[model samples]
Target: MDIKTATALHRLRLASIPEALSFPALLIFGTGFRLALDYDKLVMPLGIIHGVLFIIYVVLLLDVWNRAKWPFKRVALFFLLAVLPFGGLFGDRILKREEQAGVIAARARKEGTVNA
Candidate 1:
């Protein structure tokens, strides 16, 4: 792929790492622990932070999907993984693998075009 597309994939892959862990962190702090442990001060801020990150991640996911020319199913699956309880880790790995495959295939296609 071109530099811009490649960059998007790279960024999305990186973002998935944090996106994976942030949900549970947000859930833990925003929910049970706060009431059970007396952390009222933390709820609003943590919820806000998680909301921002979630928004950012969704935007990035869409951008990467478009830039990478991904299938609708791929994008949908990624979104599903993003929202699942512990799906982020799997999502990150899947993105990494997909990104690598896309880059490699793009490189091969470019080489074939140049050779032709």
Candidate 2:
């Protein structure tokens, strides 16, 4: 992998944790606030927030998919994780493992331990 690709992988790994977390939190908070408090005032902001976070997550996912050359099924699974309750955590774990593996591969390639 080139320098930019490796750096992008690290950036994606860092962003995945929070991106995975935000949706669940938003789900709980947004629903509760909508039911218990003001509708248009408070919860609306949360909807917007969720939309923004979701967009960011998708963009990051696409970038990772392109850099990593993930298959269609893997990409779909990750996308599904974004919508499923608590799925983001699972996705985060998978992404961390993937990043670690990628780092290992990159290092091996750099040291000529593995054939390119």
- Taken over the whole model, the C-alpha lDDT of each candidate is 0.78, 0.75
For candidate 2, give the lDDT: 0.75
Cα lDDT of model 1 by residue, 1-116, tens digit: 66578778788777776776777877675777778987687778877877777788889999988887889998999889888866867888877776787677678777785342
* Candidate 2 local Cα displacement, residue 66, angstroms: 1.4
RMSD of each: 2.5, 2.2
Off-target runs (Cα >4 Å) in candidate 1 are 105-116
User: What is the TM-score of each predicted model, taking all chains together?
Assistant: 0.81, 0.81
The window of 10 residues in a row where model 2 has the poorest summed lDDT is 1-10
Candidate 1: C-alpha lDDT: 0.78
Task: Return the clash pairs for model 1, or none.
Answer: none
Candidate 2's displacement at residue 5, Å, is 4.3
**Prediction-by-prediction clash tally:** 0, 0
List, residue by residue over 74-99, the lDDT tens digit for candidate 2: 98998888777667777877777766
Error (Å) of candidate 2 at residue 83 is: 0.7
